[model samples]
Target: MIRPDSFVPSARLAPSADALLFIFQEGRLLLREDGTLPQGHVEDFSVDLVNPLGMLDGRPVFGARLVGEVPTGFMLRPLRGVYGTLSEDLFGLAGYAMQIVEWDRTHRFCGACATPTVRSERETSKVCPNCGLTAYPRVAPVVMVLVTRGEGRDRELLLARGPHFAPGMYSALAGFVEPSETLEHACHREVREEVGVEITGLRYRFSQPWPFPHSLMIAFTAEYAGGDLALQPEEIEDAGWYRVGSLPTLPPPFSIARRLIETVAQGE
Candidate 1:
């Protein structure tokens, strides 16, 4: 199993030189050559530099942009790529840039006094003109649970699939923790909301920084309490208990949800 701890980015040595190039098509990412970031070191007229994500094949690959059509750009690239490939790191950088661009696009007007906001020179931040409120890259925290039950032969973990997921996909129960709620509370709420099942005995398992537009995934293990499995109509399409010794297909290794489930199932 590919663990999240092993995933890497290459551009770490030259922090001061990388740039975030915006391939603007009336303001949307161009998608052709879907994975080649312009060879900045060899090319002149490089737009802007981004933080070095990491190196690819000993050649440093920085986050970059290319000229392309606007209308099709948004629909062309999927936010999360399913399998591993060289494009994976590039995709991460692209997604990170997209998040910054999206934040800037959406926060043009200040919320406090309704005045226009401006991009800050301080890097990856914005400032409101009227109230001086500063906004930085936002990262939301979410919790995922591997809820299990049964003393011996009956031990199982709860898995669920959402309507938005691809076919035959099953993943750990997850949800963003709401304001004023504890991590344990978030775990319980997500289970109830997604699978209509109750869970107890929550224990922290691990965490990963999932930078698909900034989310921190917190993984946990818990015990199943009494409740029937009922798919939440609006969110989930199916759910069930799978014996611990055997499992269904899981999310890719980059996801903490997959790591957490695997760790528990392996009796680690």
Candidate 2:
């Protein structure tokens, strides 16, 4: 429901009334001592660096990097921890800001010529001074699939837990889309590699912007065709089919994995 009218990015620092200041340090977002976004005069924070993100509704938004000691009334918060605590619009904007800041920080130098790069005047990119190589923010696409089998009372969903997931929490199979591979191909390959199963009727569901480090998650619902569970030792900790009556812990509500499961569970 939180939709921005348009995105107009700028490299210059311009503060306005409706401008949002996204200050980050060591990969954590800075918030007020009362756990709220800083909304007053921008000069109070003593920001050292600022990058204009875009315009939302009609106001400019900026991303800042804090250099000095933490401000008197500000605190650092982990980006993931602020997901459900912040409004959807604000959270989405924060994700965008983080990605932009990271891209700027990492691409300060050119990869090919080993020379310092400068920001592009006309776009959100870094141009090499010597080689003229342009580097844009990287967005990795990942595929997620919720596999189901049977119908009526016997219906079951296949869920798997990655090694990094919280204890007892399981979600759909997912993998990064390999270069030169189609999304559908990535979907089929992930299912086979993770759980050793072949999926049929791969139907596209939806996509979500996941900013753990810039991942666009594309979800799907696939019918379980054949093969047994042969979990990938390195990636998958456990996997199984669960009936509606008995399901394990799931990912957070803000995540697309939970939505994909809920949509099929509710017969939507």
Candidate 3:
């Protein structure tokens, strides 16, 4: 249960440290002539960069979609890549930077006071000019759970596939934690709303820092309470209790949801 903040800082060279930085007009990161440096030397640049986002070896790469004029001969691709692949550290920092910059760019106009917000410059934050309000990187909290019964039980953890997802793909129940509600409360509420089930014996599992525009996923394990299983319309396209012996297609391995499910299945 090592928390992200628990990691002690060391004399580490961060990816963005003395590294070239670029913001694509199309939201992608621009690559240098050698595809090594993101753009130019950390400071001065010359030629115009292309829109970020394009595929390399068929893998989705982002940093595309510039905010201003689009560059010619620029490619477009997805923003995810396998860990340890080409410049993992660089991509990681780039992703975080992209999310922050994008959020700042879109939220420049303060929703609270409708005032123009200026960049903080001190760190990752924005401040409103008129209201004098400061806004930081927003990380939405989401709770995902692994529901289990005793060992050798004929029961299966609940799984569901949204209509928008690929066919036969199932994922754990999840929902955003509302203001004034605890993390456990959000877990129970999501399970109840999505599968018409009650959960008890709550316990913390693990967590992952998902930077899909910032989401802190808190994992938990809960016992299922007896209830009529019913799927909420629109929210869930299909759902059922698939026995652990023959579980359905699960989420990708990179997801904490899949890890939670796997841990429980192993009788942990």
Instruction: Assess every candidate by TM-score.
Output: 0.72, 0.93, 0.75
After best superposition, candidate 2 residue 240: deviation in angstroms? 0.4
Candidate no. 2 TM-score: 0.93
Ranked by TM-score, top first: 2, 3, 1
Clash number for every model? 11, 0, 23
The candidate with the higher TM-score, 1 or 2, is 2
lDDT of 2 at 176: 99
Which digits, one per residue and each the tens of the lDDT, describe model 3 over residues 168-228?
8887888889999999788888989888889899999888767665788899989887787
Q: Which stretches of candidate 2 lie over 4 Å from their true place?
A: 1-3, 6-13, 40-49
lDDT of 1 by residue, 1-268 (tens): 1112233444243532333232322234434355433343313333332333444445444443332333332323344542343245554455555555555555678777778877665455668877888877677999988899876656788888878887788898888989999988888988888888788788998887665556778889999888988788887788888987778888877677787887888777
lDDT of 2 at 190: 94
Per-residue lDDT tens digits for candidate 2, residues 39-91, read: 64466676744677777666777787788789787899998788777778888
Candidate with top TM-score is: 2
Provide the lDDT at 164 for model 2. 92
**Deviation of model 3 at 43, angstroms:** 7.5
Clashing pairs in 2: none
Candidate 2 lDDT: 0.85
Worst 10 residues of 2 by lDDT: 1-10
Off by over 4 Å in 3: 1-39, 42-74, 81-91, 153-155
